[model samples]
Target chain A: MSDQNKSLDPRIARLELPQGESIVKPDEYWGTFEVFLQEKRGKFHQHVGSVHAPEQEMALVFAKEQYARRGKCVNMWVVKTTDIFAFQLADEDMFATTPDKQHREAGMYKVRDRIQEYQNRQK
Target chain B: MYGGGFLPEENPKKQTETVAEDPALLADFQARIDRGEKIEPHDWMPAMYRKQLIRMIEQHAHSEIIGALPEGTWITRAPGFRRKMALIAKVQDEIGHGHLLYTAAETLGKPREQMINDLLSGKSKYSNVFNYPAITWADVTVIGFLIDAAAIVNQLANSKGSYGPYCRALERICAEEAFHLKQGHDAFVYLATGTPQQHEMLQAAVNRWYKPIIHFFGPSDKESVHSEQLMRWKVKMASNDDMRNQFLDMYVPKVREVGIDFPDPNLKKDPETGKWNFSDPDWDEFYEVINGNGPCNAERLAVRKWAEQKGRWVRQALATPYTKSTVPLA
Candidate 1:
């Protein structure tokens, strides 16, 4: 009912501050875009954070300010988070490969040992 | 300082006591935490774990948003051009930090709009310190220097915490806070070492803020109804008492070195135990302020409500019909 609550901050005190008027529906927000930042020219643009925006261009604008304000950013990319087809974190086990794939490993076939054996066989 | 995540202990049963999750999944999750791995958004976390993290992160996000206002009020009134520019940057950084924390919280299933609604309707709590008014430039210096220093202590500890997104957000926030602390400390030192009038104003501001500073780290461990599972999960990196002691040990000397004395006569550390002792900062006042009866609580929420209400049209206009907003996968 009051124009403004009595505030020590003069600006607030002078304004007609509104109260109890927020009615944002659950889906009434701009979509979230995941922001990736490249620290330098040669670096990969790693996902730093996300920003909510109306479109791709605005997302990049917001992403630059929010994620790259402090860092030495050469470039940035913004992709809608909904666009990302990510594997669930619980499926981390799926990415695990058997360590016993020794045949596939470079260090498995030891050239040093083979050379030593060949010289000994010659002797 | 932004105090750690807090929920009132009224519902102790639902809050921390019972484990209602599947034992096998819970054990697997606990094992992952024990191995020093972060809990990502889609991980099979215990219900209690998800609930508590959401509450804590949401509280932290709200604190960052509301925390900007007290110092922000001083931007136009800042004494010099340089101070004004620094204050402006610091305020923007605080708002940006709030957005980062909100995104982090969203990964845990709560929507950002809902969080804002809860904050506006007073269903959630933020750091209690922000409810106090910054009446003078000296108050701004105290907040910028000391309060931010305290936040860094809490936030650094939280950055080592188990939650992935929250830790990442805190890392960025803590980095930016360095500039805020330095600028604040410079101004506080100027006031402390300046003329008698400046010194008097600084002292008065310190006296007003001393109790809130003590209340910054939440209740001491003895009084707090915290769960041990939170500690085991790395959700809580340190106890409230340990953090308070650390803050005092690091900062008491800094304040004393500049000839600005804390209002308490009994503030001192015991050489034997390395613990500082001081007069009781009224826990009653702490509780009352948190319950929305503080000097600036009404004003703070009122202003926040205004922002949400005023900004609604732009957000609504920007909403696209085909866009589907989902939880961020990080």
Candidate 2:
């Protein structure tokens, strides 16, 4: 924990920084915040937000302030960017097999309607 | 008087004090923001406006985190498997809300760690209502139903706020809160209509939570200073009193319909004014709670501090030596 304040270790810093062309990106320091958004409490987490923070401590703070400012957030997860494995947007089509399916959904409203229809038929 | 659109009336108090900003500059800023311009981190804003937004947003973030504790207490001891799962999901949502709010604050160029450190150091504020203890399981339902429902009203108003990110965040939050309100209302309905003992428990919970709900909106407009600047900046879309009245107008009848009595004897609706009148919350108590003197303040802070301390290793691990190569953030 004491090491949380220390600058990047010399060996790790050398390994992390890209050489030459990749270094063309001007913003050398990039941080990742893992975001969990709640529509409200008692619901599954929706990935509605993320932010960049240099450290885990900062990320936690950033996550709460950035993601949970409104009264609706019930929880948040802020993790360093390196930990999350996500597919690139350039490969978006590779993950889009059944991207738009609206017909077969059955939850909350659907269940309510189905139950009401069944009760009406019985009546 | 009813569902007032955008900004309402000019402040009469401005006659006594010089308006803080050059009217033209403020108007220009307001017009740009009204046109759906995104106010970036380094954008020019009035000092008072920035300070007020920070206070409001940070307190809101703190409220989301602390609001979880009361309901979180009931998770393990919930009456049944379904209730337990519901409580767990609710608490998780509270954590998620905290994340959304923190990000909102970060856009203001304030360091997130500084805010958390301030909260832990007793230098920041959260909602005053959270300072009250939740001593009964029925209190959990009251929190979900009445408290969350009231919050939804305020968030709905904020969805139209002038600040771009805050407005967007409020839109998402208000959408989620619709579910939360229903879940809480369902829980309250089950308890309120169940066994006699359950009914009594819910009645007691309502009695305890009612005053806190009134206090939830902070204070009347006269007592608020930053409110005008906040309104001008589109930071706060509704006055504290206006939001409180909306809560009472919506929830009071709902509570009565459920066969429970709210504790306030003074609660009555003025038909002509279209407002519900109720006894004011103790401003002293509200200030005390915001200043970290309320009943649950110590416990709430202790829990957060413990989590931070206990999780120190986890945070350190993420910053460790070997994994740095594979995990280049950029």
Candidate 3:
């Protein structure tokens, strides 16, 4: 409001803003939700980013504004960040299939090649 | 978006200067980085890495927020209907960028409110360029064109950085920047090739903005504390000087082709060395502006503080039992 804080832009000058310190309270930004984006009709929704909103509907709106603004996003899904179960990044090696379970892998069945060899031997 | 030149203030007591960590864990962290794996928010990391990233990302977010203020001043006065729409869209994108980045930084444990408090209280810094005013439409274009380009260079390199959340945020920010750059270039070219008065206006803007543009990347790497460990950790993807040079290399010709160039006569490429050499941009002014003494520094902070104060009721009215927020899991 004073000459000391006078701004060049008329809009700011009009606000007559007083100069001082102000603090925002914790959680003033609200809860978080992970946004999932589907680029096309047949594509699966992949997690892109998170948005802070009070509820799922507002979360979807914010997600659209944030993640889908510049890209080809056909649809979006918003779930509370708290809902997703995640494994520890350090435990990444646990997901790998052990070599002993090769029988369960389709590639491990070499029966077709073995049959070819037996047929050739019979010939 | 214009986020670097941040070497965390070094104190002899503790900083990047020295911090002892468990060697085995440090090695594993360093190895992960070396192998180009992103360090996620939940993963184990060095205290220094977390601190540095929090500072850089927070600073960047603050930059995007404040960076919009100067341009937001011009929406009513933009030359035509299309430019008005473009400017409005670009400004919104910038604010959106700030919000996205705050979330990214929050994942590192500092809450978004704390970051806002820091910004309002002047405990942190944003890009120094926003402290300057956009005196004319030409000035806004310069900011949209050159400042955005500079940010892209800084951010593109940062997108390759080892932190997962930061890299993700930068990827999104950079995507929208293309439109901002094109809109800026179109406006700038129109003025450059238009009437003599328009040409003069744009020229004056370029003359005034060149020094700040030079300062935008931060202090020279040679003058500042050497952040070798940060580079090794991928916290710093490129040196400040390197990013500055890259900007000048890409943009100088673009400016010159339009019959206007930066004011510095010493600004030229040494064909022998393939590097641009420009006069010293007066680092003291840069530091002075950063310490809150520039032309518009007071106005900028004052406006930000006022917005927060005025918006208090809305925040409170909206605050349900849900107001107890937690840091987002990335």
C-alpha lDDT of residue B61 in model 3: 94
Q: What digit string (tens of lDDT, one per residue) describes model 2 on residues A73-93?
A: 767666655567766534546
Which ranges in model 2 have alpha carbons more than 4 Å from their true place? A1-30, A33-48, A52-123, B1-25, B34-38, B223-225, B320-330
Docking class of 1: medium
Residue B206 error for model 1, in Å?
1.0
Model 1, residue B24: distance off in Å is 1.6
Ranking by TM-score: 3, 1, 2
The TM-score obtained for chain B by all candidates, in the order given, is: 0.96, 0.87, 0.97
Q: Which stretches of candidate 3 lie over 4 Å from their true place?
A: A1-5, A98-123, B7-17, B223-226
lDDT at residue B55 of model 2 (Cα atoms): 61
Query: Each candidate's DockQ score against the native complex?
Result: 0.61, 0.04, 0.67
lDDT over C-alpha atoms for residue A63 of model 2? 70
Instruction: Report every candidate's CA lDDT.
Output: 0.86, 0.66, 0.87
